[model samples]
Target: MTQLVGSLPPRWILRDPYAHQKGIPRFPRVVATVLAARGITTRPQAEAFYRPHLLPEYDPLLLPGMPEALRRVERAIEQRETIALFGDFDVDGVTSIAILHEGLAPLGAATIPYIPDRFSEGYGLNLGAIRTLADAGATLLITADCGISSVTEVAYANELGLDVIILDHHTVPEVLPPALAAINPKRIDSPYPFDELAACGVAYRFLQVLYEHLGRAFDDTAFIDLAALGTVVDVAPLIDENRRIVTRGLEAMRAGLRPGLQALARVSGVAPERFTAETLGFALGPRMNAAGRLAHANLALQLLLAPTAAAAATLAEQLNALNRERQRQTEEATALAEELLGPEDAPLLFVASEHISPGIVGLVASRLAERRNRPAVVLSRGPEESRASARSVPGFDIVVAIRKEKALLVRHGGHRSAAGFTVRNENLELLRDRLIATAAEQLGCQPAARVIEVDAQASLADLDGLEIKGLMAFEPTGHGNRKPVLLSRGVELREARPVGADRSHLRLTLRDGRVTWRGIAFRQAEADLDARVDIVYSLQRDLRGDGVELEVLDIAPAAAARPLEIRTG
Candidate 1:
């Protein structure tokens, strides 16, 4: 996984074993070892981890302003007041808009969904946009995936005789907005249970509470599927209620139930029965996000709002084509950013160019940070202002770093791992310097190392039928609840060759005593497979409907300290 051509290999750290010292009825050994490595020691925790449940969702009324927001929405429904939903331009934002609009549609509410242009309006509330919405006869303005940090815009909305309800999940800014209801779980004073919910999760909770308040029963889980899409797409942790939401959502999605999903699956070449977290996060999410990143997000929103199968199929095709274009642009932008970086010793990297699009800065930064293993800030410079997207390593909090430089920024907000901001072109130097200094303080002058973690050291015998079924118990895997990565030593590489059109992947046959395992390592076409190796891998079903295959993450020659006799093709 360490791709730097001449760099020393990263130290692989296997997770330490759990005590199980209390003699707590030692679990089915192999499965217990995996579960214990992930911190699920108790039997009840194991049960909850294995079987995710959505029953008895936390009360949304516990949210600081949810009850008040519900009351206002109820009144709006009774009086038939015009309502507008202001949403962000990403998949989470799009799904939030769809969920809220669909949730309120049956109540005779006059709802209009509005997504701001990425180039023109950027993110969150703006006074001009508020004036436009109010002018368009919107008496009530509800924000989805945004508006928590728009203190000024909310104040203006209030002055224009428009009641605003802000439903967001981003880290709260110091100064709160004066909206009629700002219902973010991350509020400093909030008593609501969980704070890690994606924006769409919050929106779903609100709707669920509203349904109860209206004396309505909704066992229909189609909406949960929407929430699940937004949650996984936004990279929300799949733990606790988030796990339940995604698991149930995946169940609904794989059933080929929702029109939007069915059409999207058809265009994306996803067989519904085979849908999983991988399909959602890698395939569907990126296509939906492609429209938002390259053009207007309303195209993605329209796909969700599509009524007919043909219309949905057409929108999905459009998005698929746009995604191809996005990939090309992203490759160009990433190469540009890499070319602009300084020496390799720097703890942080900041790259700016007019060549990169404001919409794609986040994508570029994410790629740079993941590849080079550090915080990266990619800026797209405009004539007057520049938009910067920041992505950080696991330990550093990029959001906190961005917050420290707020005085030099026009606007900034995001979670720990990712963030975005706008800065005046002239203040770019000051912003850059401050951010560099902050990263140094947060991460130290020493560089962050690239490390691939292994969950446990295992032998081929450990992966029996019991372990396989136990592993399957932990379904709907993604962020937080990740699939385990195991390392096995001294595996004989019987045969290896490059696969794929670009010859970027290695298809290998590995042997363990009498048993044999088939595997593929991504981006390791030139790997040194001539020598016996230790492999880091995950167990997965073969793509060809065969039994289990090993998905190789990395391979290190058996003798680590000794020089490798690598073959040069």
Candidate 2:
């Protein structure tokens, strides 16, 4: 690949053999090895991992603040109160609002789904929105994907005779908001077994409990797809409850997508049967987010809640246009960020410019962070204040680092790996300096190289039949859980050349003994391939209807590769 200056080469780490491999003897050797690597060593564990619906479903009532939130929702329905559903402009937030609105409307709740304008309101609950809702006869205000840190805003809502219920999954602050019920699994005293649900997941669970309390059977098949979309798009860890939700949701989607999603899939050129975590992250998620990034999130939300195919198709096309514009803007912003960064290496990358849009700062930060292998902060400088987004490397906690300088911030909240904040222009330079010093103290002069974990070492022949099928069991992989990588040594590279319109991808033909395979290495067009090389790859469906193909991740010249020590402890 075209290596960036100061970027460290990726370190390959092969996992040690699973200690309890013998417990899952029913699986093929390769399948068992890969399953064991993921901690599924027993038959029951394997069954549950492969068929997630077999896993135990935690009681929604166990979630912290569930009872209060549920009872308040019931009361609002009974009284026919106008409930204002406030959500963030992101996919998770929009999906959360859609779930609550669709679920509650059938029960006689007068719902007003509202997403703040990205330019005027930024993120979370704003005083102006609350006042507007109150004026429009909204007695109950429920926030999705936001409001956990909106202590002042919640108090203001309470003053306006509006009862606020916060449904959020972000990192909670030290002091709780004054909402009627602040529902989040991250609470210190939360009894909920899983703490990693996306905001949409939380909204889904609330509806489940609400339905049961009202003696109605909640249809998971109808709503799980939205939950899955939000979970994958928000980059929530795909384990435990999240795995089950996505597994079931994908099944439902394959069975048949809702009208809105059907139109969206048609526009995105994705078949429902081919739905995977990658589909949500790369296709649907970005398109949904593009509406908010370039225009208004309501456009995307309307598409999600569209009741007819005809209406949805037009909205989907509009969103597709917005997504294209968003992609162009992000590319321009990323290029500007690179230019501003120049040819230097720093413990942290910080760039601020009026040219960058507030909506695309997060995307810019994410791109720079991945390219430079360190934490990155990108800010769109407003006249008096700047909106900033921060993305971090695997081990670095970007939000925690930002929280240290909360005194300089107007508002900030997010997960460990990602965060956003608003800062007065006067404090921007000092905040950047302090953050750089903090990162330097922890990361030293240069950040460590990224590591790619390999599940097993297998020949090209070993990855066939049951082995390929077993690998398919790791579907819907993204973020925390990824497709397993296999290493094959000294494979003959028959051909290698740049592909794609932009020549950013490599098309390769390789052979191992009598078996031959075609591979594509994305964004690695500049990698110098050898005639005989060690290749690290994952199996993926061949889009051309040819069976399976290798998604090459990395390559090295023959036996020159010296991997890091295997972890045995």
Candidate 3:
């Protein structure tokens, strides 16, 4: 039997009973409990949570630097100054550039969208790219998704007589770059109620303010699609204003996908009517990001900016090929990284390799962090320098930890959960030691036991009336919002067999009373289980799309001699 996390079984934490109090609309006990778990106990809260259209619009000007950013943009437009849209080489950056270009171009602003090559320029605002944009007669440079920490690059731009405006959402450093306007909701002085907007969301908000300043109504339908794409791809929390953006954006997408996205959807084999947040996150986002991860991000930008369906189709096919290659490369790199990992139970998982692609180090780090339930750092080592990407488990602030050792780093910036830094090869080991010690003080030396938060406990028969429509009302579930998980106890495991290409998954037939449910547990083929089990799972549409199936999260022996303890909070 493969022990869960080597020794510790996953702790089951049941939802707090206080959230189940009255005031919420009458729903199935399971559904109501799930809503309460999410703090939607009020009628209005439920409405806004379920139907994002009901949420009130937040004022775009609430951001700290909004007024200054608006002024600079207005001045550039009035003077017909060419503005360069420099963005990061990811979905968030690509979509940010696309949104700004589409919004500003119609208002008589000459915008040139530029995404630096991931392989050559690395990340953020590079001096060479800044010099190139300046030489191209661009008097104004608007950096999307990045540039929050480019003090040196911004200074260079200023020397070339070009004003810079930053639209980003990364964690802000104590000393910000000297840009004309640094508009980011994460700024310490920001008054914005929600600070989790993706870079494209910030760009969209900027456009809203710009259009209002020009005495024109902002057409959200024109650009919300791109904003939503970036938000999901960047893993921004799906709450508050972000929820509204994705909800409306999804409606817009189903009504009509842009020519570029339409082509991508076709190539991805998803019908427009079937497009959901999952499609964006799982299908479209990966394909779009593949270009930046394995090749030049300009390919993705071209697909988004394709004027005709034919042009979009060609570009979409290329991105599809790139995505496949990216998957292969990531798999190979992850396997190599696992081999290099010193110990599975280390406080922090840090591995450096010349085999890992710098562009995919973040993805590799994310995988290791999830698998080990610890903070993970993956570095792509070059001759003299190494670029590292780190992913942290909940409760750990990776960027904050990395910031403490900035003396040895050339440049570093990112959010609490994810961060990246460039460091000299000689200091790599010392930096790793410092980070591991910091993580150990916080996370302990051993891997913490994984915990599964159960929204409700139910029998298989109780879910017979659970309509797929009602369950699916929880659309756009990711990051901050997650699909509800249910615990079904004392179920008979009638049949279990390995499935999938490598037989790495378990296909299960479970029964409680007279009701039977089919379930699939991924990567659990070797899990030794009792004939009867208590399973924690989420309900989802089966591959056939006609009925529901259990996507099991965890399982334990049924009716143990001593009933398994369930912790309630």
In terms of TM-score, the best-performing candidate is 2
Question: For residues 1-569, what per-residue lDDT tens digits would candidate 2 score against the true structure?
Answer: 33453355577887655533443676777777777777778888877778888877899888778899889889999988999999999999999999998999878899999999989989888999999999999999999999999999999999999999999999988999998999998888889999999999999999998999999978888799999999999999998899998888998999999998999999999889888888999999999999998899999899999999999999999999999999999999999999998865688999999999999999999999888888999999999999999999876788889989999999999999999999999998899999999999888765467677888877876676888888877887887678978888889999989989899998999998888999999888777577888888998878754478999988878757656447654
Those runs of model 1 whose alpha carbons end farther than 4 Å from true positions after fitting are 1-8, 19-26, 561-569
CA-lDDT, candidates in order: 0.83, 0.89, 0.87
Ordered by lDDT, highest first, the candidates read: 2, 3, 1
Clashes of 1: 0
Q: Per-residue lDDT of 33-82 in model 1, one digit per residue for the tens? A: 77776777788778787676724667788899998999999999999899
Residue-level lDDT tens digits of model 3 in 115-173: 99977888899999999998999999999999999999999999999999999999999
- Alpha-carbon RMSD to native, per candidate: 4.0, 2.0, 2.2
TM-score of each: 0.95, 0.97, 0.96
Please identify which of the two predictions, 1 or 3, would achieve the higher lDDT against the true structure.
3
What lDDT score goes with residue 223 in model 3? 95
Clash list (residue pairs), candidate 2: 1-527
How do the candidates rank by TM-score, highest first? 2, 3, 1
